[model samples]
Target: MASPSSLLSQEQIQCICLDIFTSPISTPCGHNFCMACIGGYWDSSDVCQCPLCKETFYRRPDLCINRTLKEISEQFKTRLSLFEEQYAQPGQVPCDICTGSKLRAVKSCLVCLASYCQTHLEPHQRVGTMKTHKLIEPVSNLEDRLCKKHQRVLELFCREDQTFVCVLCNETDHRTHNTVPAERECTEMKVSFL
Candidate 1:
């Protein structure tokens, strides 16, 4: 069984190489990797190891193109570019360190430099199809950025406390926080603020 930390969900992996040319290719481990990405990762290894699972195997595997994935990548890239243009701020957008695409300020972390797209987001927990990547919603709030008490980036929001705090907060101070759905939080907050 693959542990949460060991496996990268397919959706998250697909998001990473949305800008790259991706075709489905299987490794000897019976796992799929974006053809171009795996080709580069394989260039130096004697046996290709699954990047996510670390399962190693011999022999050249099949190169199969998943047309659906390729199409999704193309459409995602187009949408991302349009989103960037629509939300451009004066002189702030920079190419993300991981994906090398212009950051659209979708998510940010004070501890982790600045902004990242869905591609470069880090997974806090691996769920089903989409790994819930940990990220800051607005990506920029200089004042209440890092937790004042814990000095950690506020990742998850506590519905009970009506506050944003790091995971550590859940383990400690806000352990008993009666968290509600995020949509509930948004709906309530929106109405209150308006």
Candidate 2:
């Protein structure tokens, strides 16, 4: 018998299965599966609990395409869009450091000088992992967001004295520049810049 972790990892598209099971037609959470898997793996189990996840399925399992699978597929499409935005430069080479596995680059950190796809990004935010990486989506205008020099935090807003400032900047450069809150400036700037 395959280990539970290995079982879930198998049969996933490119080993990227978020959730998958074998027997009992169940999910990792241990629901039940009959109708859903019968059409796919009927010869194996007329009634099967998810071998990968260990979920239990009730009798007379309903035959339906797995919505969970559909959702994951859609998420992959989004990842692709994010990758395009992050690597927008002409002739931008494929991510060489990432094992050449094609995944969506969903985030970038101006400070860290690194780009991360969906797979690596999650582990970066995980509790036990280092949380040093900053993440931003495509629509956040991350290209123009960095400081021309430091390239640290994005330029969020300027003070009343018109000094570009981040939250940290308030305490450093623009401390005496009649600082107005960024939220208020954002509200006003939207009308003109938008």
Candidate 3:
């Protein structure tokens, strides 16, 4: 497949490129423009015509989204995002799935033990099984959530030790100690602060 840059000329891309390609439409004259761009242009003028070709239409044609063009635009955007993310800032979490150019992660899944960009994170949001996984703001240190001894996610806080502990840790080392869910512990600390 031709790269997005090779598929569309620089001028064509610029003509159609708005803030982002929301709805792309193709004119009967075989030219494509963003739906809003065409609508806005026509709304201000006396005649409806292709912006590029200036081929006037006697009557306003019903515009439908150009699915193929839209798909191409989407692919272009993904490639652009990946290109941008390749130079991600020092603190940003790079997406694990992105190979050559890793995009900044929007969410980190504890179950998957992976960070994902907005595009790559869609499956986690849509899939029923993945939806139940604990998703947190992107954090570089995933190992902090795992117990060194138990190799399980540290979900509980041992009040006595003042540290995170996994379920097995509560059963073993913290058997006689006061423990609570990390969220509960955090809430209690916040209440105390207030």
Candidate 4:
């Protein structure tokens, strides 16, 4: 059986509007959503229904803030705020794996799709397989660093398109384009100006 902690991740995604979950509530159908999200959804619709399950309620359900879920969500939100607080500083990234008050991320692992502070990053540095994962300076929105089409890390720079490319992109769409590792492209561009 999956733990509640594991299930909470899915619940958070279901409750949030724009990836921000606040004020969780449950409908009669046992579907959970944010109070604001469901309220706004129903206020604009003719029938009150579960957005996810599509179970219709002819009358508005007497929705109250789900106490247990609200508490759990609050704790999660608190920790999340701590995680984001570090990233608010200039040139810093938040450690996505942090549990409590998080420190500034020192590096981002492309394979992990996560940023880590120096302490949290110890495993990647010590583990052989993890060491093979590309570690770059901490950057936010690590998903954006992936090639949208290939869903691979954008490691190569396509000089023709002036955009980042994944390995598959180099094999397919960017096969004819002049390509180099982004680091090498940066160095070459710097030398050209000097």
TM-score of each: 0.36, 0.36, 0.55, 0.52
Give the worst 10-residue stretch by lDDT in candidate 2: 15-24
TM-score of 4: 0.52
Per-model root-mean-square deviation over C-alphas: 18.7, 13.2, 9.3, 13.5
Please provide, for model 1 over 73-130, each residue's C-alpha lDDT reduced to its tens digit, 9 standing for 90 to 100: 5655565556546343666544254443355555654555466554445442244433
> Which lDDT value does model 2 have at 35?
38
Cα deviation in Å at residue 136, candidate 2?
1.9
Tens-digit per-residue lDDT, 106-159, candidate 3: 999888888888888999889999889999899888888999997898889999
Prediction 1 TM-score vs. true: 0.36
For residues 1-194, could you state the per-residue lDDT of candidate 2 as single tens digits?
A: 12333333324422112333322233435344433344455347766455555455665344444567555544544554454465434443233236634334566655554556655566668845457655544223454565655555644555566645666766677666676655577778898897
Model 4, range 21-82, lDDT digits (tens) per residue? 56778889988888888999999998888998899998999989888877776776666565
Better of 1 and 2 by TM-score: 2
- Residue pairs with colliding backbones in model 1 are none
Better of 2 and 4 by TM-score: 4
| lDDT value, residue 26 of candidate 3 | 80
Give the candidate number with the greatest lDDT. Answer: 3
Which ranking of candidates, highest lDDT first? 3, 4, 1, 2
Q: What residue pairs clash in candidate 3, if any at all?
A: none
Candidate 2, after superposition: displacement of residue 101 in Å?
6.5
Better of 1 and 3 by TM-score: 3
Q: Candidate 4, which segments miss by more than 4 Å at Cα?
A: 1-91, 191-194
What are the Cα lDDT values of the candidates?
0.59, 0.50, 0.82, 0.81
